[model samples]
Target: MPQAVLDSPFGQMIMPALSRQIHANKRGGGILGIEQQTPGSSVKPQSQLHHPLAKVHVVSNLAQLDELLAKFQKSCAVIFFTSATCPPCKTLYPVYDDLAGEVGDKGVLIKVDTSQAFDVGSRFSISATPTFITFLKGQQENRWSGADPSALRGNVQLLVQMAWPPHPHQALNLPTFSNPNAEPVIFTKVPPLSKLLAKMGSTASDPAVQSIKTFIETRSSDGPAEATLPDIAAFTAIIRDSISTLPTDLLFTIVDLLRISLIDPRVSGYLAEEPSHRTVTAILAHVTGLPPKDCPYALRLVTLQMACNLFTSPLYPDQILGHPELRRLVTTLVSTSFLDGGHSSVRVAAASLLFNVALANSRRRRDGPGDVLPEEEQVELAASVLEAITQEEGSAEALEGMLLALGYLAYRMPLEGELADLLRAMEAGGLVLAKGRGLGGCDW
Candidate 1:
């Protein structure tokens, strides 16, 4: 029996007397042939186990029952239909409660006694006692009349499994492998969006900006209902021409707006599939600026964000990597920011961008006749990452990001190559020793 049943006011009045009788029977050498057990030596009851899940709600009225069902309407639910006079219900009560405790966040488990809530019984057309009804996303799924504990457990387990099936990749254990399905960065949090747009003044009324904004809103709300999206060439051209003339802070606003569209395949794919690759060209020119050093903090950060988001579609990064100039521009910007930027946040953002580049490159190599980074490119990036890591003083956040980027860059590189030579050089410089000491919890 459930502990709740034994703790009620009526139960409290009768349970002690019942327990004393049980104890007396045990002292009499057995109850149903079970041996007498001393206090504290008995088996731990299932009720005593920790069950962090929501408890089974015993609803007594139609309103309360409706409210309980409404709470988990979007999730899986199970209701134990019971009545006060049902003998099997009393037998199954503890089992149902235990199942609820085990169900946890996967679904909701509730109990309602038809004897107390006659209106609820009528609503569900309950004609029998101790019925179990299963619901998936507010719709009736399965129901049966009986109090078989194993069947109840099997059904609830199956419902939870259906709702949250295990991921296909969970069993694979590849430490350095990249997830090809990972989407690019989207700036979901638009703080003071109106203010940011207003900063552009009359330029906010530009058709390209308006089109980009509309596309973002539509994709967010309706999610690819349309067969077509805004023209990538037109949007990129407008932004490229405008970026050269915009103020530094406003540059961030434009890039921030543009990054959201990268999640749309129609838009991002244009940069990859177009023969001319005009959008990517515009991006590289805008990011590099007049002189590389002249790139504003806002532009650098937002461009890094854009670069990270480009990973949503492999084509963008793959296309950029195919072109020597574009690849050099991205590598230079990221390396400089990671190595020399005075701002810790900028370094961290740049490190993340580098990580994306390395991950994309690795994924491409694994897929076919692809190259992650050429031997020289790998060595160059690893050196820049190591320099940044060594110079980093106390920011664990930045250090961790740099270390991850380095891991991605070096994980699958040929052991006999330039990257390996670089690692050996780092060992000579005590970098390997520091890492070993750090892992062993020793002061470096």
Candidate 2:
């Protein structure tokens, strides 16, 4: 929770404004749509224990059980019907929870205390305690009456396998595509700060601007541990104020400064936590609003670089994926940049940003509850990547980046969605095969 500090002779000039801005934006709300709870202030509600993502959901009534079943209609589900006084049922509780955790988003597990939920017991015709039922795609697949842990585990595992069968491609001997690197491609090279700042001319003398320059220079040379952040609030305020007044040609200078500083997690984390995301929003909104043909190449390139750097903070992936306005702007920027044939560097940078976005969404699907990127956006990105690949006759680096980005987006996606259909319609497999032939032994 370290705030970015401003240290310079001009600190006095911006202190009052920064304080006022901070006080004005100070309001009670949670970050990333999750409410922040103070420790020891309140206990979590029992309802939260039954979250969709929780390992085991304890239903209180027939209605609650029905709702959960409806929500997971597309996946495997298991219902544990037990009585409070059933001694045998207690033995399988831990085993059931462990199985739920192992299943993750692939299936749902529900525990119903029939002793209290008499309606549910009646509805399901449960005459015996410790009865278990397995469901696949909403159909009753199997039923048994027991507290045997081995039986419960095996049945649930089998149900999950039935729900999501392994893709046939997994059996292929393509070692190159089996496990593509999940790491995001990032731009970390630091440019000469003194010379870079000189491009700003008189604006470089502004206290906020100078402080950011010092931060980037110190962090670049000595690393983040030795570098204290600049007053990000004040720096952001300056950028906001200058957007309307700064010449279009000169704006990239300030944006490049931010792009370099954002390489540090501390800097990017602060911006990500800002309630309005005003600074980052202002910069991207203005740049992307311009006609693609008229947008300055330097500004566009650095802006794309800054977007990639935002992924440095663990907080930002959620921000980029969950925030609708930000997600749209970023997707637009990336999709358009993919076809920027005039600038291979711009296309490469766009490919890297796309990879970061895909990598974030991929990890969410793998480790968390569900995908943050909507299917429509996924289809749009895949189409753009396909077009880029077909047109890519140069820059192996750019081509590789595009291929990786597409691979992540398509990874584990259900074969029934629009993304899959589009891939089929476009003959994506044939396209990739053609690209491979052109590359001639490129391991890809």
Candidate 3:
């Protein structure tokens, strides 16, 4: 017998005639088990052990497979079909698992043992011991049968590429858009502690207020690591209780105190972890709810600065962006402050706050799958920034901050959404270009 014939599985069974019939059936598209390859196909046989870090879903039945497929319906998926006794199937296990780790949440990877999942085997007509199927957007895209690791990797990569094509913005020559400044623009200047505390009048005597004063003094002199945090619960209560009763002018004093202490991660983290974010929310709500004429300039300025300082804690950014009520109040305050014609400083501080919010949202998009700030809020913010950019004339610092914030918001944003439409409607690109000219050719 020929060596090819000797190496055939049928040779072991001593059933050459049966093997011939199977090959003929495969050529005629009747037998689904055998891999059909072109004469010059690049796929070659290869194998590997299962990868330790790979997160692969091993489904035992059709229901489990269905559930996984449904869960990742919009993403790419690869299903490996194999039997317990198949040696060739063992070879590609590691490659498949490694690919699962690489794909992560971008796609789904599944392995089904045909011996244990007879129903799954029948569902896909997986007759061969080691078969591979790829799905894109819930539809079957391709199928092959083999132990070829290279082929498996190529097909899966191609499916994922088709599922999530690169955004056109990614190809732009804008480096500023690509690399956002992760460091939030914060106001760290500490005014005289005695004078700042004296502004609080009778509240200055409260132990919570006094303790925070010491914490701020120590933090300013020795740095955050050396400073001990004051009682967060008592301080939060002080802010909550004072928001209602404190004279509007003196309210800025307490907020400034909170803002200074918030430079410490411990204080900011405590407020961030609060179930309702009640303390920060109360201050912002009370301040933003006031009519523009009634809201004190000192209070509003300190509030904006306080909002910017919240980003010092890694925990607060997500809460500020993720919590609906807080998100609304913060955005409202920033947007309202954007139109502050009298206080260019207030607008500058507001722009910094906006930049912090956009920076946080941009980081979320970069590190994860979806936008942390909802699309509607993004649209609202972009509109506010664009309006500020158009109206901005005197303060280049405020304009610079607004432009940076706008760039972060627009970076890697989906090109086919309401935001894209709004950008077009407002001719934001032209507005930015005009601002660039006025600013004597800004870098971004």
Candidate with top lDDT is 3
Please give, for residues 4-107, the per-residue lDDT of candidate 2 as tens digits: 11232223333454345332423333211112333443332211222234579999897898898988888779999988899999999999888888788877
Full ranking by TM-score: 2, 3, 1
lDDT of 1 at 210: 81
RMSD of every candidate to native, in Å, equals 23.7, 15.9, 19.2
Best model number under TM-score: 2
TM-score of each: 0.54, 0.78, 0.77
Q: What is each predicted model's overall lDDT from 0 to 1?
A: 0.65, 0.76, 0.78
Candidate 3, residue 135: the lDDT equals: 89
Model 2 Cα RMSD, Å?
15.9
Better of 1 and 3 by TM-score: 3
- Model 3, 26-118: lDDT tens per residue? 222101111123344332222232222449899999889999999888877899998889999998888988898767667789999988888
Task: Judge candidate 1 against the unseen true structure and give its global Cα lDDT, from 0 to 1.
Answer: 0.65
Error of 1 at 335 (Å): 0.8
